[model samples]
Target: MAPVSLKKLVKRYGALEVVHGIDLEVKDREFVALVGPSGCGKSTTLRMIAGLEDVSGGTIEIGDNVVNDLPPRARNISMVFQSYALYPHMTVGENMGFSLKIAGRPPEEIKEKVADAAAILDLTHLLERRPSQLSGGQRQRVAMGRAIVRRPDVFLFDEPLSNLDAKLRTQVRTEIKKLHARMQATMIYVTHDQVEAMTLSDRIVIMRDGHIEQVGTPEEVFNRPLTKFVAGFIGSPPMNMDDVTVADGKLVFASGATLPIPPKFRQSLTSGQKLTFGLRPDDFFPTGHGLNSGDAEAVAELELPVSITEPLGNETLVFVGFNGRDWVSRMLNPRPLPSGQSIKMSFDLSQAHLFDLTTGKSLVA
Candidate 1:
């Protein structure tokens, strides 16, 4: 019953407003991630929920209580930051149990809580080690262990893995996922990394310029983005975008390339309307090499020139010249594609996206 409700949340720094009238509900035991580029107010929103920042307007409720005016400790939540915030001189056990110790909890109770959290995070062996002696991942786990021992109603993580190396980030991400499953606690994570938001959250809140752009499950945001900004921001290497216009019942690119109007939008789009066409890198494949080979009704073929190829072990990313831009394509079967080579590529229009140029809203529906 530890659901969190944010009602028309707003934040302002004197004369400047940052987070505007954003509302969200985080279900009990659900993991929701707040994600957006810098200055989008994701962090400010999270801080408001944690009672770390004062809400300029709106109400924040935890479970059944209005926590807007409550202090961070009174909100009954724990936060993990990018800085780990561990005491360098204190041993892991001491650091993890320090909050309880400060609250006048008995030594025996603190020990039990610390031991339990340590075991859950696989840090029992490192309890005696100081932060200075631990690896980056270990320090983060200790930081998480500190939060777990509090047994708070909600957990807030602010880009907790941004400092880790690539390999370590992947490993810790898996560990955090496991931790979430084991605890089943309601959590709200703030991060700029869409990949982290996709992998860790049950739902994602995408924000921009003090406003929320979209809120949906990772699949919904990735496969059916509501706006052009979200379609381009949520994917790795992102979705390709090109300016286009409706002419003669066809989608004509500014570079003079043309694609037949997708049947789904033919009735809604008027002639002379401008749009931003979008296609994911994975949806564009070399001929006979697409993931959906059996589905060819919406497939369009184009002989495009390659600009560069990046080999990533099991797959290669082919950068092809399209509409006078370098469009990336993910090739499943690994192969060396020479630059300046012309290759037949397939565009899966079945998965294509179109946004109104004037509004940036999806053209569909």
Candidate 2:
């Protein structure tokens, strides 16, 4: 953040090249999330930005200054790590004031800064407690306090809530988002969780195989993914993907099921052209005299024997298999679904996605 720019960035270890050339311009005060699967270079990229790792190629500029050789502290950035990186022996006050003390700030100034950050993060009450006495959320807050007291031009978060329980993670996610709004400071967060990326990011750089798959707002990446990988990776429950072929001007799945192609899509595909069909489970629903009913062509019914039924308080997720592939359907209303019952399911092709089989690129632009 603070307008970080990576011009043709690359990372290499001897003969192994992990990150190819990547050019990105991160605007000042923007909260951008770099998200991808493991080994996809998201962490490596963040480390490089933090000056924790060396860039094998290209230039990294932080606020108009090229910081290619600067150390982490010299880069004027504070990072909240996944491990919390808090000293167990230090009290919260000491932990939060450590950075200021290291910078040779006067004791009174350090004390005032720690107090201010503690108040901001609601950690003032726990200022005298050791990390050993704190809960996971409290410890994480102390780490954030440690980072915020520096008042760095930019902040880096490397999955800081990964260690927390589900409820805590959710709470911290909201807190982090609100804190960003409050601070109005530049930030770059890295995570593999799609929900984390979608909820927290102002803009996301979707990464794959050391390359950027797509970079856009969450809605853009979810509603109109540029690549097959982005479409599959960025959705909860994931988008359903299956081999498909154009037959008789219809979208034909490999299992012999057929769905009607949208008018624009039907005109684009060549008959017999091999493709892949993708759709989020939430995009499909029982046909009613409503929004997507008439638009869905060739409603192929599936007599699916339910394999698993997960009924939460507000919704039900039914797991069913079809032709060696698992299909999940999310029902908003809570309904008891008995296993082995033949459930009728349909595909809504109007909102479906078509990918080129060879290139894994979206066919319907």
Full-model lDDT for every candidate: 0.92, 0.85
lDDT of 2 by residue, 81-113 (tens): 999999989999999999999999999999999
Q: Per-residue CA lDDT of candidate 1, range 1-365, in tens?
A: 29999999989999999988988999999999999999999999988998889999989999999999899988889999899999998999999999899889999999999999999889999999999999999999999999999888999998999999999999999988998998889999999999999999999999999998999999999999999999999999899999899999989998999988775677888899999999999899898766863557788899999999999989998999999899999999767888999999999888889998989999763
lDDT of 2 at 74: 95
Give per-model TM-scores. 0.98, 0.94
Task: Indicate which candidate wins on TM-score.
Answer: 1
Query: For model 1, what is the error of residue 46's alpha carbon versus the real structure, in angstroms, after optimal superposition?
Result: 1.0
TM-score (C-alpha, index-matched) for candidate 1: 0.98
